[model samples]
Target chain A: QQQVKQSPQSLIVQKGGISIINCAYENTAFDYFPWYQQFPGKGPALLIAIRPDVSEKKEGRFTISFNKSAKQFSLHIMDSQPGDSATYFCAASSRNTDKLIFGTGTRLQVFP
Target chain B: DAGVTQSPTHLIKTRGQHVTLRCSPISGHKSVSWYQQVLGQGPQFIFQYYEKEERGRGNFPDRFSARQFPNYSSELNVNALLLGDSALYLCASSPSFGEELFFGEGSRLTVL
Candidate 1:
């Protein structure tokens, strides 16, 4: 029940295109969902996050659309750039837990 | 301000051996969490420490252990290392429970 499943093991898009990665969680206790970006050999960096109380949250060109009833959420990178190319992971946690449950990563490649 | 920092960027161990990885959290942050990321996969939680006290632990075996210092730094030790233990060990810090996590570059452990 702690699993957060992510899909599109890999994605390819052109510069200026939109890149999206999806994730679903099985635990209903999860209230916070966050997305992370990881470059090769580096630890994951917090990109954007949202709470279940809200339907969406945006930070710069990155946006997260969350569906509380569906137990799913997604990250959308607008105007995707090569610099944004990296492995993206979606994670979830609740105020009751100190640990964040992460999803299988999605490798995104934005081509010029 | 310095972010979370990890030591011995890489190490190699053999079966039946033991290994230790270290981490120093961001100044003023009292919560630290450790995770293991195998190649091409998301990080799996290992342990979490808050205020020098263990607050959470993942589904790892008894061979895995960790401790936190008064300074909020931490160490993860794994005994009887197996080849499956070869992976990147990541350390993340947060100001409090259920907060955003900032990570270090991570230590790469190779068990042969």
Candidate 2:
């Protein structure tokens, strides 16, 4: 029940293409959802996040689309660049809990 | 302002040995959390500390324990470490509970 399932274990996109990663969770108690980007030999870094109250949120070229009824969320990268090649993770957590359940992760490779 | 910092960026230990990993959260941040990431997998929550008190713990075994100091620095201790315990240990910090999290580079542990 604590798991956050993510899809497309790996992805390949060309520069200027669109990249998308999807995630779903079973725990309805999760009120907070965040996406993290991780690079080789480094820790995961916060990329973008969204809550159930809003259907979507955008930051620069990154956007997060959230669906409350489906218990699913996705991260989209516009005009994907080689610099965007990294592992992306979707995470969920509840205010009542101190832990954030993370997805398996998606390795995104943006080719030039 | 420095980001979260972890000690012993890399280490090796034999099975049944004990090991201690340390983390110093960002200055003025009071909330600290620990996570374990096996290669190619998303991070799994280990423990969370706020105001020097343990606020939450994950499904990890009792062999994994942690404590926070007055300075808000934290330590993760593992006893009878097994080969399965090897992974990247990450420390994240936030201003308070239910907020944005910043993660450090992480400490890589390899058990023999």
Candidate 3:
């Protein structure tokens, strides 16, 4: 079973627009939610992360809004740029396990 | 400081053959995890090791095996490779279990 589900397999946005991606999970034991950005031929880099205790966390232009009760979370990128065009993956993990269950991923493209 | 490093950036093997991939975690990191990413899909958890011990494992078949050294470096071995095994293998490291992970560039395996 897919532990984490992500929507909009691909996305396109104009420069400086707000790009949003959403993800949902079924496991309530998940406590750590993180977003990773991956470029072609490279590894996924840590972008932003949030815990269940916080409803929202923002870093630079990237923001993560998490809803524990709904078992949902979303990533928002403000002022999306062409350089930000890459694949984004959302992941969840529990304290008891070191494995991270990842979403299928969302490919984002920013056009100028 | 150096991030996670993986060896054999690309390899090709015939079906029914065997393959091995290596990884070196960052300094002071005690945990190492392996993931597999098929084309256009997110990474799937394979195994996790902490302090040279196996801490967690995914749902992969018995053909997949891994071990961690005392220095925290890890290796993933696959026996009787299948075409479905072709994918990008990733290694991630963290200071401990269930924390943020730093990923390596990954080793691409192609099964013929």
Candidate 4:
């Protein structure tokens, strides 16, 4: 079973615009929500993360807005740049488990 | 200082063969996890080990097995390679279980 689901499979945005990706999970036991970014031929890098106690977390231009009640979270990138163009994945994990359940991923393309 | 490192960046094996992938976690990290990323899909958790002991495992067949050393490094072994096993195998390390993970570039495995 796929615990986490993410959408739109692909996205296109202009430089300096805002880019957004969303994900939802079915397991309410999940407490840690994190987003990762991956470039071609590279490993996924930790972007930002949020906990259920907090509704939002921000790091630089990347922000994670989480809604615990809805079991949903979204990633927002302000001033999206070409450098930010890559595959974004949202993941969820429970405190009792060491594995992470990842979303299908969103491919973002930033155009100049 | 060094991030997670994976060895044998790429490997090719024929059906009925076996393979092993290695990973070295970041300094001071005690937890290591393995994930499999198929083409066009997000990564799926395979196994997690903490302090040289298995902590969690995903819904994978018995063909997949992993072990961690006292030094916190890990090795993933897959037996009887199948074409369906062709994917990028990623290794991640965290300070402890359920903590943020730092991933390595990954080892690409191709089974013929």
lDDT by residue for model 4 (B25-89), tens = 99999999999999989999999999899998999999999999999999999999899999999
Q: Residue A86 CA error for candidate 4 (Å)?
A: 0.2
Q: Give one digit per residue, the lDDT tens place, for model 3 in B1-112.
A: 8999999999999999999999999999999999999999999999999998899999999999999999999999999999999999999999999889999999999999
In candidate 4, position B66 carries an lDDT of: 100
Tell me the tens digit of each residue's lDDT in model 1 across B1-112: 8999999999988899999899999999999999999998999999999988899999999999999998999999999999999999999999997889999999999998
Model 4 RMSD in Å is 0.9
Error of 3 at B25 (Å): 0.2
Error of 3 at B6 (Å): 0.3
TM-score of each: 0.98, 0.98, 0.98, 0.98
Model 3 residue runs over 4 Å out of place are none
Ranking of all candidate structures by their DockQ, best first: 4, 3, 1, 2
Considering DockQ, which of the candidate structures 1 and 3 is the better prediction for this target? 3
Error of 1 at B61 (Å): 0.4
lDDT per residue for candidate 3 within A1-106, as digits (tens), equals 4489998899999999999999999988899999999999999999999999999999999999999999999999999999999999999999856689999999
- Alpha-carbon runs more than 4 Å astray in model 4: none
**Residue B108 lDDT, candidate 4, scale 0-100:** 96
lDDT against the true structure, per candidate, is: 0.93, 0.95, 0.95, 0.94
Instruction: Give the total clashing residue pairs for model 3.
Output: 0
